[model samples]
Target chain A: MPDAGSRTASIGLEGGRAVTARPTAGAPRSVRATAARIAGDWLPAVPLLILAVLLLVLPTAVVVLQSFRGETGGITLANWAETLSRKSDRRAIATSLELGALVGTISLLIGAPLAWAISRALPAARTAWLSLLNVGANFGGIGLAFAYTAVLGTYGMVTLALQRLGLPFTPPPSTSFTGLAMAYFYTNIPLFILLTLPAMHTVRDDWMEAAEVCSATRFQFWRHVGIPILTPFLLAGWVLIFTWTVGIYGLAYALAGSAPAAPVRLMTLQIGIALNQSANGQQRAAVMAAILLIIATVSLVTYRIILRRATRWFS
Target chain B: MVFVGRLGRGALFAALAIYLLLPLSAVLLSSFATTWTANPLPDGYTLASWGEALANPRLQAAVARTFGLAAAVLVLDILLVVPAVYWQRVRNPRIRVVTELCAAIPFVLPFIVIAFGILKLTGFAIPSLLGTPPLLLLGHAAIAFPFLYWSVDGAMAAANVVKLNEAAQMCGATPLQTLRHIIVPNIGPGLATGGMLVFATSFGEFALVQVLVGARFENVSLYSLDLLTRTSADFGTLAVLTVLTFIVLFVISTGVVWSNRGKRGTAVAGARAMTAEKDA
Candidate 1:
């Protein structure tokens, strides 16, 4: 019930109506005091502010400026023009969206259930299951791609085993679009679990008890209580995963045979291709990065909004 | 809800375990294979790939370099985030918003874009930094920002570092002494957890190093990539390298879990902070 913001609400007590009675003494207010407080807040954080500006702001600025810089040493929109006009670039953007949606849907289906299962387990099992999921989530990048190929590729162990059993279905090679989807799914299911598990704990058994006392069937309780409580958290999780799909590089980069010829032309891989194209390529890469940045920012903000709504619902 | 009761849940967990364990164990299996093709398991197991992995100069350099880079990034993150986060929590609470925003840049930019930005700047503005270890080091530190920030913030809030500092100072202890004897001891688990994640992150990082320096300053991830891409490259070597890297990460993660042992899953502050971070 006691959250950070409410707990600190009494600190300044501007109108002298404090939110809490903690026997706290309020500092006398004056113009000098206000100035000193502002100074206190900003001054100690200067080094951090500088680092934030230098590391995050400066490089991002470079990306934005370079996006507009011309190859002939003059400002030009030719790069942007080509980028927008190109079919491959547009397809890459489409691919990113489709991939995000596909992976998000599948991961949610698997991970949400797994999270519920883990949440119901004994504490020891719960901890161990989470640790395994953590391992799975972190087992990524070149290693993940390479490992997936060995397990699910044309001559992969699983593929070969399925062949021996004369199964009707054969999974695609890890380099193929379907295989890449599977690989992304492998990482994402765990990620979804990790992100949504905490929100699950917020569901109380007492609420379900109250529902049963109201003569509600188990299914009815889930429909009115469980799903509604978890929908926002699940949507937020989906959005988070979707955001990563657009920007993810390492996994796709490893799987990309060559940037331009990659089986899947994710926005990130497209940016990689653009960066390697020379002066014009670098410019194109910048423009793409900026576009991707905007999409990522918007998706992340949506995630935050959904999460805020979820928390408010909980309260 | 009865449709998926205890029995159904057990089946679901079993499936999850297989999905998680299959590929990784396959990698391990391949690493020890003398020759394996078109089979459920390796035809023969040998230490040949492990030997080859150890013998290669590039692999050795890559492994050593990855550790070095991870170490540097972890140190840099602690230096930049710990004191700053502590100060914000204890002295300037309002600055929390800015710190949080800055920390979440990694989530918004996607690492590839971050790599691109860094690559572009170093090419023109800071030519000396281009293709240098320092640039990659800085890149890793920047990307590893949110992990350290959230960890320290949670630890500070949990320990109520402010109240501790106030209590100590009121009792006439110097600021440095309070930090030395009280703050560090209390936030140790948070720092350790965050440090582990940062180390794991930098160690596994591929895109930035691959784009910026490529084979020039090859770390383990780049080395694994090199084996995958090159003609006449050995999958065995790649598998061996990957397994080794996974083991290191596994140990670090175990350390993370171990440090939070008594607190139960609910109070695994850093682990949960990492989840919220990815939410960003």
Candidate 2:
């Protein structure tokens, strides 16, 4: 959404007639005029442009570039082939997909009801719930792994207590696939709730009132009205958590070491392996990362599309 | 019907509370426990873990540096994000769609990928500053940019910055003066909200540190991760550090989030406004 006028103004001024007439006056006057033009017309966009370029666009370009180039400085697709052909790589991919799907579905089931309940609660309760969700969302990545370990690790309090009670099931350590999924489950639920809470309100109290006046029970109301209205939002939130979990590296890494000791089946760990393996490892990582990004970007685009449609009814 | 609804709601909230709080209570108890075995409660409690963990001078220094970096990231976020958000809200609706996409990038763009990108960029471009705190400062700033933007974007609307800006302009204030004196002070709560978000993000970030900087520099997250992975990782010390980190994050966020007088969590306030249609 670049402002066409401001863009043209800056470009035109920098290369326009007045400046061209004194082409050799490349001193403070020219610089200040250019500076003033930017400051006056597009000051706000400057920082964002610099950040987007340096952090995202440039790095992505480098990765994409590296992914396509061979070690001999020649262009090739062998990196892509190798990255996808490896059995371990395929395993990582399947694991990420499985984890994302399972976590996404489970979180939606738990979070949707909670989000609705919190949305319909009083202001104070809503505030408390939202605050708790905010903290949980922030408490992800490494700290999340530790929290899970604290209660679910081999010698953890929960595991120990369960053993004491003879529950017939020992909670796995945070370093296992089950443990990673459980930790992610904790994280995704709050995120789903937070993102979907606004959509829950989109159900509108008056709509509920109208439905009830028409001789509807709560189940009938939700089945016909609430579920219909919230479906797109639920789907949107689902994909978001899925894409998020697929690329989640930190929580997985912190919970399970990058080595095979813990055997966390994640594509990110493959990237980590590539980081440590050999000189050409980064190339493989670049390819795998590109592949992961493709999955995430496609899913995210779907999420945005659904989110747009869901919010279309608002206002 | 009403009774059933109450029962279901009560069960939902109760389960939620347990799910969220149980893990944290484990960490809390371990931080104070002398021994934890197959017992539901700690056999005995002592301040030894806390005392020993905090007594390490290096750990103390790490805490200071990590918090300092967090503060730096917060400042950088304020400087970088405020203008972009203000620009989007007040001046240019043309950029809203673009910035919003940018805002959503980190969600799908894994930080591990971003870390590798940064490592390549910094190590290739500026070999000297590779793996330094400055690299992290820049990375965290960019990473946390969207969070700050989200919060401030909400605040800008709640403060009605456009109207306020116009009113100040009519009263003979320059744009700079208007932003500095009028708009900023008005969005004070928003800045604090954004600050809390940016601070937590910077402080707790693990992947960037683990990947880009690694053992060369250790933040709280790195410290905990390192301790856990170390062959002789001390559980007592680990518990103390984990609890300490969570408490720091929890208390600061609770204070800020609550002190907003629960302005409906300005952090997500923009979600509603997202579909509210831009008045600007």
Candidate 3:
């Protein structure tokens, strides 16, 4: 109570009341401060909070509700059952995972080394490279797709260059799923580099120096020290890239010929097709279920990982 | 020791740099080429693409509309969110936890799902909020709120709100007066950075606009998409437009990064002043 009144009196004093305050006066000022703090902090969160929850909950609920209902009124799991049994739907799921995994792996292989090189370079060089990588990293989806089309499309320069070089210029499979994966991997490399740059700072020259002094081989040093220290960052970055690649539609949409050919047509694309085809309720329900499943799984996993990691600082 | 490895490192970094810059360079090249059929190199060079893209009246109008919508969304979001976040920060931990979780949903939920929900719920309403520019702005603001919230919240967290408020009260300033006189000026950098970020994102966004508004109102990105897909492929015009977009994004992103860094530096000094004033 005394603490509270002192805070209140302090408010009174600062507001130019020009009066000396007792311990009792601080209590009300503290209460008012607490009130003001709450008002300021929580108010801005409302719109986002409301929108996020609705977005997370609503479509999903609708999906689940619709997926079960028959053409008439009987509640059944037939839609979900059908989603799995249907060859096209099954292929869609497989394609999404395969493309995501491929992209994630390739990007990691290329990006990690680049990140290491940049981190170990001179400060000026590192800053310039990092800035370039930042732009490239963000230049994904539509922008990258467009660029690749110009550079590697049927009439792309790369295709032409290969022809002039007297090499077998087979258009580099630009329209295929493989080409799409390559594009995704290219974009992911910059992002991977950016994510791991912060963690790479943890690897100091002194540590490398000690390793060299000890006469450890380069591979040995990486295996024993570098990998272990960077495991958390690597895992975190990989998971993000993996999930992002899974949900990507733009790159695949732009490059792939159609719903069937695209290697990574997502549930959302399926929903789009259904909506366009006038499948109506079933399409909505299907989208709801797939998105709900995705959101729930991702949120749960990310939350658990982040929570465990966060507690390490305190421990 | 680092000097010994400098040559190898420089070569490596240079390769990485080429990878990042090449695609952009290619786009620029294709745009300027007067005759760049499926040839390995351009046959000639000209400024026709730039003229072609700019000459179209619709494309010009869409660019203007996009800028207007971005500005409006930036202002509307800041005005609405500041009050909400400011109040939440003052409240108890329980309230803060719930609110923070809510704000994070938009980021986690993909644009596809959000578009579906918006279209479903607001389908019949006209000016057809989902299909109109204003509707797009509203959807954008909803999606953009979290970025602004975090930026401002981080700024406020750096600032000592409790002390600032109490000090203002002691100086005979009311709640409204304290917010305007003390808090707003101090957090101006955060506000500006957040606004710039929102503008950059909304300006560049393609998915939401494509789905929500369809072709009812086209932004630059959409226009580019249409140009690529339709008619004779005009590589030159796209290249010019892309270069223009890249420059705009670079400038906006630079402003946000610079302002946020400046705000971070000022936060400590601002905190000290608030504490000093409180003690006095």
The best candidate in terms of DockQ: 1
* iRMSD (1 decimal) for each model: 4.9, 5.8, 9.1
Would you list the clashing residue pairs of candidate 2? Answer: none
Off by over 4 Å in 2: A1-39, A123-135, A259-262, A276-280, B1-4, B87-98, B170-172, B259-280
For model 3, residues A15-96, the per-residue Cα lDDT tens digits are: 3322223235545567777677555545555565565455444544545555666666688776777777777776667776
Positional deviation of residue A50's Cα in model 1 after best superposition, in angstroms: 2.7
- Residue-level lDDT tens digits of model 1 in A1-315: 122333334322321221132234475677886687567556646766776776677778888887788887778888789888888778878888899899998888877877777767888788779878977877888899888878877678888898889885576755567877888888888888877887776667898899999999988988998888888878888887888766777778777745345666778887776665444567777888888878878876786666666666433
Q: Compared with the true structure, what per-residue lDDT tens digits does model 1 show for residues B118-223?
A: 8877778778878889888888888887777777766777787777877887899875688778888999888998898899889988778877887789889877
Per-residue CA lDDT of model 3 for B74-183, tens digit only, reads 98778766766555444322444554554545544555556665665565334345577777887788777667766676566557565776678779987668777888
For residues A113-212, write the lDDT of model 2, one tens digit per residue.
8887887887877776776686566667666776786777767777777878888667866667788899998878888888677566567789889988
Sorted on DockQ, best first, the list reads 1, 2, 3
Give lDDT for model 1: 0.76
lDDT of 3 at A61: 52
Please say which candidate is ahead in lDDT: 1 or 2: 1
lDDT of 3 at A157: 79
Cα displacement (Å) at residue B141, model 2: 0.7
